[model samples]
Target chain A: MRIRCPLCGDRDSREFTCMGHETYMHRPAGEGWGPAWDSYLHLRDNPAGVTRDLWYHGAGCTAWLLVERDTTTHDILRVELASDAKRGNA
Target chain B: MVKLVEKTPAEGLLPLEINGISLTELVPAAITSLMPFDGQEAAASALLSSLLGMECPHPNRSTGRDGARAVWVGRGQIFVVGKAVDASVARHAALTDQSDAWAVFSLQGHGVEDVLARLTPLDLNRAVFKRGHAARSLLGHMSAVILRTGENTFEIMVFRSMARTAVHELETAMRAVAARDALR
Candidate 1:
């Protein structure tokens, strides 16, 4: 599989590490430890298609990527800098 | 000033100069890692350009005269190749010294691409990855900055701790390529 890196262009999948879903990134920050921490750590839904995911470009660029991909076809729909995407959303 | 000695990053194996390729260990006089401060990319680029006497290279590119060169490492980051300049030593940037953080190796000669192909998944086509281009890619199981300095010359910079392993992997590929060529 090939992933289009925002900085390095399309590169092979070997250079990247999929860091799970974007849900973890957007977990609510609150006053309690139990519920928030549990949801953050354990309650992750594994969707089948068009999922927003996080991947680390470990070997190239070394940037975190927010990737929208189709889990069924292993097709990448879109990729953006995680920092930029997160900030814009925030 | 304390005197400095040069040492090659080898996995205790002797350096090779066979099958039209030679692996030479290099010690650049300086290796400063420059990252532009947020919103200071233009200013950072200008400073490096003035110092380098050329436009600062953009992503996956490199520019400079032999002794003074700049290789782009990633977005907002560059490694100035010259005398060791301190982090923040240049204006409009956050800097850090990486002179000792990496082990530099020069892989030169014909059939170089064959060896690299055995390791990295990236395209090493002369048309695509021409001289003066750099890429951070996997070299064996470790990550490395692969810079093409000449038509048949490449510089591989890997972390110092992984230097021994990187050299071993390259040496193995070199030998394999050589053997294959001999058969051909």
Candidate 2:
């Protein structure tokens, strides 16, 4: 499957590495240690169907992307720059 | 202290010509990375225009005449090629000298796209990928920046450490393409 990078156009999937989920944007900050940190660091849910995940465009633009894809069908629903998604622009 | 002499990344390994294809190292005066701070895109672009004498390139597009150009490397980042960037460019953007960080080469000849097509996934057809178009993609297993500098000429940039690997890959592809042509 090809992933369309927001900045680099549609590129082969081999150029990207999937980094599990998009929860990387929700790091437990300032408050420090607690169960929240534990959950953020260790716990994860392997959900099927449409899911949001983080992908690094390592070979192409080197941009972090938030990819919304169907885990079952492997159809990419959307691809946005993680920075833009964090800024509510995606 | 001993005198230090500068050597190019592909020193003694390039200027190779096989059949009609040639691969040669390009030693530019400087290659600086230009990255605009958040919300400073317009400001940085305006400054870069006067300093580099060219418009700041858009994503996947390069701008400027020969000997001086800006090739977009990634989102919010551009590589200023063939010219020593002006100091004022830093006021609106972050400037980092990448002169020695990359191995730059010029690959030229007939069926040059055919040579690259075997290495990269990029569509190298001349009809769509014209002069000034650029792409950040893989050349074999190595990440590379490929730029179209002319109709039959292309500029390939990879990390300095991968100079030998890059040359080897391109040379193999060049010879294979040349051999294929010989069969026709």
Candidate 3:
């Protein structure tokens, strides 16, 4: 697998670490405290198809990435900086 | 101001010649980590250009002028190496003292890329990965900054605490390549 880091360009997968789902983008800091906290802390969805998730470029650029990838086929559809995506959405 | 006595992290392994390649410790006269303050790209660019007398290369690339070189080492960060007249370049950017944070070494010879390919996930093929290229990658579990300083030379920087291990891993890879070459 390969990821094109915004800063580092295309790099091998070993340079990165899968963080978790992108749903973590919605924080419990808002009014959805209890259930969101439980879901953030405990519950995890194990879907077998394409999903948007977070990844940390631990060994490369050290950027947080939102990766849209297929869980079953292991094909990456897209990647973008989480910070940029958040800002764009806002 | 008083200055601490400088020591290269891999100084003890100076001139580590193996398999026709020489792994030598490097002590760049001035090594600094420069990061732009948030939303200060224009300001940072101006100051760095004035200080470096050259354009700051984008990430994954390196640029040099007047003996000073800058390599993008991380997101929004660059590691400047080589000698400079003034040390006050920090006045322009968010500076972190990296003179002690990393151990710098230069591996030079014909098979240098072969040795690095064993550790770097980034392809070291000469066709694409040539001089003025920089990358952050893992070298045997240690996060490293790899820079192609010349046609036959690569400068590697690993965290100071892991300098010894980094040297060992590099040497082991060099030896392995040599052994394989001998059998051929």
Best by TM-score: 2
Tell me the DockQ of each model, to 2 decimals. Answer: 0.80, 0.80, 0.88
- CAPRI rating of model 3: high
Query: What does the interface RMSD come to for each candidate?
Result: 0.9, 0.8, 0.8
Mark the 10 consecutive residues where model 3 chain B has the least summed lDDT: B83-92
By DockQ, the best candidate is 3
User: For model 2, which pairs clash?
Assistant: none
Runs in model 2 with CA error above 4 Å?
A: none
Model 2 lDDT per residue over B112-137, tens place = 89999999998889997889999899
**Model 1: docking quality category:** high
Give per-model TM-scores. Answer: 0.90, 0.94, 0.90
Residue-by-residue lDDT tens digits, candidate 3, B1-184: 9988856687667678887899988777777788877777667767677866755678788888424888889888887777542445555568766777788888999979899989888888878888888888888899999988888999898999998999899989999999999999
The residue-by-residue lDDT of candidate 1 on B20-53, one tens digit each, is: 8998887788888888788888877776665557
Q: Each candidate's chain A: what TM-score?
A: 0.89, 0.92, 0.87
lDDT of 2 at A37: 84
* TM-score, cand. 2 vs. native: 0.94
Q: Mind giving the per-residue lDDT tens digits that candidate 3 earns over A1-90?
A: 898887788889888898789988867687666877898877888999989999999999899999999989999899999999999988
| Count of backbone collisions in candidate 3 | 0
Q: For residues A1-90, write the lDDT of model 2, one tens digit per residue.
A: 999999988889989999878877888777769998888888888888999999999998899999999989999999999988888932
- Misplaced by over 4 Å in model 1 are A33-38, B1-14, B86-90
lDDT rank order: 2, 1, 3
